[model samples]
Target: MSRILAIDYGTKRTGIAVTDELQIIASGLTTVNTKDLLQFLKDYIKNESVELFLVGEPKQMDNSASESEVHILPFITTLEKVFPKIPIQRVDERFTSKMAFQTMIDSGLKKNQRKNKALIDEISATLILQSYLYSK
Candidate 1:
């Protein structure tokens, strides 16, 4: 079976994560500039077997769609246009960035390393994927 892919989309960067072919064990894949994401995915799908695309859905405390929609909707539209075959889903991303930062600190990441927003983004994507896996 093909693996599942997840994305944490940000204005500046986008994080990617993937599950194994057996659909177990989500892992952080990479973070790329938002502008480069489509091309990056095109290159990535060429080399990997991905069946599902999970995108982080940011929301406010009251469960309303946050201001992130301006960017996210466009990205989702682009994904649908570019990868029509893959099914896309959204997972709640509340507190993911905070969780990612806390996880890095708990894991003893150095201050310099923790400053890597790309790394944080990737971890957030991983967290989103893991959350979905756990829910299932």
Candidate 2:
């Protein structure tokens, strides 16, 4: 099995996660600026055996698509254009950020560490990937 890449897409920053080749474990990769994401993915794909792309789908509490859907939909279109062979999937990311912060708190991270937005993003991506894996 090849690695599975998961993305927690945001307007400003996008968090990335990857599963092992066996697809048994999900781990945080890095957070990249939205402006640089396409080029970053291009570079990443050249070196990694990525089998799938999982994107976070923001949804409201009522199970409706969030306002960000307008932006995310276009991003997904671009992603498909760029990586046409790789399959893309969406997983609800209703409160991953909140869960990431709570995870940091539970993990005994210091306030300073908890305030690191990149760290939070990575954790959010990890949660997104885990959620996708669990759903499967």
Q: Model 1, 1-136: lDDT tens per residue?
A: 9989999999999999999999889999999999999999999999998899999999999999999888899889989999999999999999999999999999999999999999999999999999999999
Q: Give the candidate number with the greatest TM-score.
A: 1
Cα misplacement distance, residue 5 of candidate 1 (Å): 0.6
Give the whole-model CA lDDT for all candidates, comma-separated: 0.95, 0.93
Encode model 2's per-residue lDDT on 5-107: one tens digit a residue: 9999889999999998899899999999999999999999898899899999999999999999998899999999999999999988889999999999999
Worst 10 residues of 2 by lDDT: 1-10
Query: Number of clashing pairs, model 1?
Result: 0
